[model samples]
Target: MASLTIRQLDKSYPLAKGARNLVLNKIDLTLHSNEFVSIVGASGCGKSTLLSIAAGLEEFDSGEVLVDDQPIQGPGIDRGVVFQSYTLLPWLTARQNIEFALKSAGYAHTERAEIAQQHLELVKLAHAADKWPAELSGGMQQRVAIARALSYRPKILLMDEPFGALDAMTRRQMQQLLLEIWETHRLTVMFVTHDIEEAIYLSDRVVVMKPAEIDQCIDIPIERPRDFSVTHHPDFLNIQSQIFERISQPLEHA
Candidate 1:
């Protein structure tokens, strides 16, 4: 399988008095191609930082992160990122926002518009394509942001709490939307979320991270085209309970 491999990953930031705040230490993980992997842990367990390193936005002091056998160095079209806050450019309309990324990637004007529209439709935001970010609802803005990220057709989608700020109902809707997109696109996804149920519902494997290491990778064998109505099914509930138990543990002792 085409995969990502991380070995002995470590990162630390220098504090004011020459002290270093160790964030990640000896962290190792692997994500196969077309896999939906959810990472969950305490707030400061470096889950998001690990994704940053994978996306090449940050560097580790030691260790390796290789995607499909190549070492990651800097940001590239192969990796896409979506953050908690909808990072949309207020001045640009939804279509323009995606188009900007395409253009910056050196795509031609006609191709950029074509690809942007395609991705907007994929996220079900085609109708709001011409609307400015400020004019759209929070959900709509996030849809546009997701469209922009997928517009590049990146190999891996790196998400950091992309649905964290939405209301409960909207969050569920977005989660379903992501699953649908995954079904059709089959993009490798590395998602970071604090929501235990959401993590179990959307991931093929829920990776529980401890204070400075991964505790376990639990495979979710739930059948796809998942019905939200069956979210409380025995099997689903079992997986949810297991995840809840794991998530509730303190990272230091996990």
Candidate 2:
């Protein structure tokens, strides 16, 4: 099983000359195996930075990040990342896009094509497997991106506001599709989103962040196979209220 562990992680960005702006400060978080966790916070609070660090895309000044007891030195095949933008190569067909990743995962040339097609169908995009990125709609493109990320069988899926650009209905549809894939494969997922209801509905726990640290890690407690209907559940509303309250308040420095 894949599990992510972070302890006392710190990140900062340098400015002009000698000044630096601290973003994530002394952060500690752990995502257990087969767990779904979503992070929510205001902009510029280093939410994305933290995820980038976990993906081994960014450097940390202090602390450690380990996946299944192994330290992450840089980006590895064990982790797959999906960004806010589609990040697909415009010229490549959906199947080709997935094939590109499978190539890096070291699959044989013949094996790559078959694996790519399988993942396309997994994301329900087999019919559009031959379509170019420019030819597909936003939602469909994101589906292709998801298919590509999963094609190599990464142990963890790191998503950074992947559906933030989609329309409401399409976003919901994608969410359901994601849940279906998750249930079937049970890959450890760490999703970052700005939507409170979406976080509550999709995550096993909701991580509330302040500027440089987490304020709370609220457990969702809501039963799985959850649909949009969970949004109206009494406990769901209560959890939403809790998250809203945490975010609305000003950060308290330690």
Candidate 3:
């Protein structure tokens, strides 16, 4: 488990022939060990950018990312990232893909296989372990991607729209799967998505981001081991409504 601190985080991109554009501004947030945090916002809200920076995939102009009071210098096993696109190797089977990550991480051959199988089972993809990415459906491919990410045993899982490519039904299944894994592993998770319902259903707290800044954060406060039944609960909609209100707020012109 790891705790995170982001203080005055800022990111900017240089224009083609002019001044740089500020993407993130003075963003400060904390994620406790084993906490599940979800971020939702508008299209250009820098949600993904923030996740990338936190994962050490991208650099920021200012501020710091600290884990367990230590600085995050670059991508490490402590932070695993899963993007919307399933970044699996088509030539490798699901089990093989996960094993490769373990091998690169310096796990012994016997240990690598054991860890790979364990994660595949965790994601309920054991049946498809032998199948190559091309043979798996979109959802199954993502399951393999998830299995690989988990095999590394990262303390924090940074997911950016990981289910955006799935159909509605598959999306629901994936959400439940993710929640189950999260509950079992108790890893710190920071997920970014545009779907309010998804954010509300899976997170301990929803961090709502505006175009250039974080707007508000709402605690879910619902009991854990969540499922589709959560949508029927009155409290669920109350949180959903709260998120909607934040999203619909108008941004003042710069």
Tens-digit lDDT track of model 2 for 175-207: 999999999999898999999998888899999
Worst 10 residues of 1 by lDDT: 245-254
lDDT of 1 by residue, 1-254 (tens): 24778889999989998999998999888899999999988788889999999999998899999989899879988888999999998999999999999987778887998899899999998898999999998888998989999887788999999999999999999999999999988988999999888888899999988766787899988888786876888988898888778768765557
Best by TM-score: 2
Top candidate by lDDT? 2
RMSD of each: 1.4, 1.3, 1.4
TM-scores of the candidates are 0.96, 0.97, 0.96
Positional deviation of residue 72's Cα in model 1 after best superposition, in angstroms: 1.1
lDDT-better candidate, 1 vs 2: 2
1 or 2, greater by TM-score: 2
- The number of clashing residue pairs in model 1 is 0
Residue pairs of candidate 1 with colliding backbone atoms: none
Clashing residue pairs in candidate 3 are none
Native-referenced Cα lDDT, model 3: 0.90
